[model samples]
Target: MQINQLTRVYRYDGIDLPIPPHLADDPQGLRAYHATLYPAILNAETVDAGVIGTTHVTEYRRAVGTKG
Candidate 1:
């Protein structure tokens, strides 16, 4: 769960659709959906690259990095 990224499980005629990155390329639709569904799981995704022994996980939708 992450900020900006909303998790939506949509049911239409008993069919479930997954809308994970709602605000990425479609913010308007995401907003509209948010207004209606009022999502249950909402969280902000963050990454920590300052740690000494580790790996950093970041959303490409928000941050960019390169590794060699």
Candidate 2:
């Protein structure tokens, strides 16, 4: 999603993260409720065809008392 859109959504969720316009224009930008060690992954079958890119995986640390 675009940064403006993300900002709007975050506002609804009570989050106020400030994102720059340049990063929003980048092809590989994302926001998540959980902190990430890596980035997001996009599959060709899931996205528009003819687009080549790298998939970054995010690993969130489970909260205390949570069982994996």
Candidate 3:
């Protein structure tokens, strides 16, 4: 059987953000870490964009709405 190493990438504002090596397997940590770099991520939704090749893709989609 062939083995494929999994990798993660976060899509933000049409750009792919690479996760730090230390937080590669830590989803929650990466979210918080990335949030620091990108405040929008704090309110953004985390969605799996599925796997492409050997990499696993995730997207930080902003929640659009007007203040009520």
The top-ranked prediction according to lDDT is 3
Write model 1 residue lDDT over 1-68, tens digit each, in one string. Answer: 64343333333323333455746457456535543553321222222223233322222122235645
Tens-digit lDDT track of model 3 for 1-68: 98889877788888888678998879899999989888999999999999998878899999999978
Q: In candidate 1, residue 67 scores what lDDT?
A: 44
Candidate 2 vs candidate 3: which has greater lDDT? 3
- Worst 10 contiguous positions by lDDT, candidate 3: 7-16
In the range 12-36, model 2's lDDT, one tens digit per residue, is 1223334456655443453432123
Q: What alpha-carbon RMSD in Å does predicted model 1 have with respect to the real structure? A: 16.1
What ranges in model 2 sit over 4 Å off?
1-13, 26-28, 32-65
Where model 3 places Cα greater than 4 Å from the true spot, the runs are none
Candidate 1 Cα deviation (angstroms), residue 65: 38
Q: Model 1: how far is 31 from its true place, Å?
A: 0.8
Please identify which of the two predictions, 2 or 3, would achieve the higher TM-score against the true structure. 3
If the candidates were sorted by their lDDT against the true structure, best first, what order would they fall in? 3, 1, 2
Report lDDT (Cα) of residue 37, candidate 2: 23
